[model samples]
Target chain A: MSQTMPDWSVLAATCPSRTSLARIANKWTAMAVSVLGGGRTRFGDLKARLDGISGKVLTETLRDLERDGLVTRHVFAEVPPRVEYELTELGFTLHEPLLALCRWAEEHIAEVLVNRESYDAR
Target chain B: MSQTMPDWSVLAATCPSRTSLARIANKWTAMAVSVLGGGRTRFGDLKARLDGISGKVLTETLRDLERDGLVTRHVFAEVPPRVEYELTELGFTLHEPLLALCRWAEEHIAEVLVNRESYDAR
Candidate 1:
């Protein structure tokens, strides 16, 4: 478990939010969160949505999301057992910003590509 | 030097933007960019704006910013030598989103603090 430091500094410090930022900026996390934005989803469903993510990394990301309070995980007691994850209100709040980033990446991708060619040619 | 793969995959990959996201999400980067939003600034000026950053880390961060093209560095021929950094248009474009994150952090910081306490107690 990570140490729980005082609240004031966590908000003030960049290191603390580095983890959160990493989570949001992660390819899998962003895609997972975006897919979850549709509604609640099971682990397998999420795995299907994001192709090529190792099971280990996916599990780790999910745990981080739960720990950070961005997503809620509910486990059911049954024969096959069921687990579901969904975004909290706070998580939902992050959607617009994350979406904005995705939109920016999509829109400026061509420009960024052009810049890369010029940047590399030099 | 980090490997420069094809341009398309970079925009598509999470790992690539992880560096850029990490750069923007960094406490110092946010603060530095915010300060630079005022206009061009000297290296020492940026160091002053962000407290507690070591010179090495600051230099590294500046290099990263320049490499990513978020900042432009100008060196002057003089007795003492003068260097300045200012944001590019793309860097300026990133300002609003970064500011939004800072504003969100400031506003919800109290709520996040409360959540932390409750979360720890459990």
Candidate 2:
């Protein structure tokens, strides 16, 4: 029998969904997902594409995504081992909303900058 | 005369838009925007509705949103005083995406939790 799911609201401090919102709303996570949306990527490639991300933070972010089932990691054995990360099916569902936020930031940065300058002048 | 806008990509290390993304993608900012989406709200009401947010953090979050032009703060001169916040047109545009993310988190928390448990078990 199907059970009724608990109503979840991120606004509620005690809701478990708050944790999920925190994870997905993260800056690094947003950037990482944006990059990964291109296709499967290697660790170094992801690090490079993400600009200023540190190797440690990238590792942590990917591990967290993996734990959350939003990303999958693959390790290949070779003369030198290789690893790749790709978004899972569930992650693909999240890509659009996440990418839209990134695009919004890019599109509105000019307006936001002007607002910041004016606010600081006051 | 109109000028061509420079390409702004969040994936770029030096892009200004990354700062905007960081602000909007913030946990408190997400929750604050979600609450303010209901319409104008008083400071006390906002604090109460957002659950465990500290007064200082809410103040800072509101100030940041105000600076970014995503929210407006109003002060009324009266008996004691009245202060309220409401989203600007730009903020209203952002509300849909931010709320979608929050709803996504709420909708997916169960799957994420199950993934965490199984991943931790392995």
Candidate 3:
């Protein structure tokens, strides 16, 4: 059987789990982590892939993800200096569950939209 | 193999999947669904379980969840009138993945918090 959250798990006001979920729940963070799925990616490239994210949002998202331990940022001291991002092991675990959520969203998007329209019309 | 989202999956502006994800990603909705996991739950019970959500927020969240096809509302025609909410099959599927996320958050909250504190000090 799959896991069931304990009664007080996320209900607690100070639960970090709630904060943790919030981190990935933002689509920008979710997509950023998605892009890094293949392997580590450069900062410029990660930003490029998101396409719709503002530079500030992307910067903040990456910093937050790194701070949350879901992503790691590497900086090299070469002339041009290199900065790339990768998922930590903890991040990979999160990515799997998160990807499942994204897939569910895509597959059921039509039903959800139809339901929304009718519900709103009432 | 686990499902991987398509390249353009969540990157598009018109993606309903992103909207759907956004709906449940809100902690209020997430916790509400978690409470209803046992079976059908009444509005008062669900609201009480969440503890911190405003009456307005609970109303809005339930309406949104119902609209998105993740939850069903049943109104019993009686003197006082009765209403209960239960997960749809689709919602149940979502609950599984989401519970995993909640569990992940609780289990690793400490690590993430430590990472955050250290990251901020730098």
Candidate 4:
């Protein structure tokens, strides 16, 4: 049987929770949220911050975040129709855990690379 | 300009860290770590435990985790040869954060689904 401790589980065959997992954990989502963790910004500005993201992808990721209720989208009815995206209180919860993984990636990347080489050599 | 605050930045184009991000944030990696977070097990057991994973996919994920130094594989050269997998200290670090995400997935999946339906209908 799958080892499911009381408080958590991803072991079921047909759990909606597994579907939810796909929502929060993605490269674009992680990057976008990390950038947004500091604060909210406009779509164009947020796109600039994330380096290699395409405009299309940035829109999709933001849409996903908004759908998940982790982000809020505000449209200011002005000359250019100003819009801004910010994390909701729910979205803010992701900051520390996501940062932990990012920090892990940054700090232990060399070790991972060396291990990768070793595995490849084998 | 990209809003790169002092400490963290997924904001740079030519960063090796960008490469590192891909390594850590994969669907399979997250699943495997969550399952293995409980304890070690044999290949058959783990595969059986995870509900919907193909054997080939599980092997690849475990190999990736091992290469990243988060998992250790042991082979006992007995009559038939037994294999086991266990988490390293680094892997243990993932338990809490990973659990947090899993819990969030469980608790908020209904809301996420509602949001998805709303987004899709638009």
Which candidate has the top score in TM-score?
Answer: 2
The stretch of ten residues in a row with the least summed lDDT in candidate 2 chain B is B26-35
Per-residue alpha-carbon lDDT of candidate 4 for residues B1-122, written as tens digits (9 for 90 to 100): 89654343445766665566665666566777777887888888888988898999899888778877789999999878888999889778777766676777777777677877887787
Chain A vs. true chain A, TM-score per model, equals 0.78, 0.95, 0.83, 0.85
TM-score of each: 0.72, 0.96, 0.86, 0.83
Kindly list the per-residue Cα lDDT of model 3 for residues A63-89, writing each as its tens digit: 889888889999999889989999999
lDDT of 2 by residue, B13-56 (tens): 88999999999998888888988999999999999999999999
Candidates' C-alpha lDDT: 0.66, 0.93, 0.78, 0.76
Fnat value of model 4: 0.63
Model 2 regions more than 4 Å off:
A1-3, B1-3
- Candidate numbers, best TM-score first, in rank order: 2, 3, 4, 1
I-RMSD for candidate 4: 2.5
Query: 2 or 4, which is superior by TM-score?
Result: 2
TM-score (C-alpha, index-matched) for candidate 2: 0.96
Models ranked on DockQ = 2, 3, 4, 1
What ranking of all candidate models by lDDT puts the best one first? 2, 3, 4, 1
Candidates' chain B TM-scores in the order shown: 0.79, 0.94, 0.83, 0.81
Candidate 4, residues A22-103, lDDT tens digits: the string is 7676667777888789887998889888887899988988887888788999999998888899998888888777766677
Model 4 residue pairs with clashes: none
DockQ of each model vs. true complex: 0.16, 0.90, 0.55, 0.49
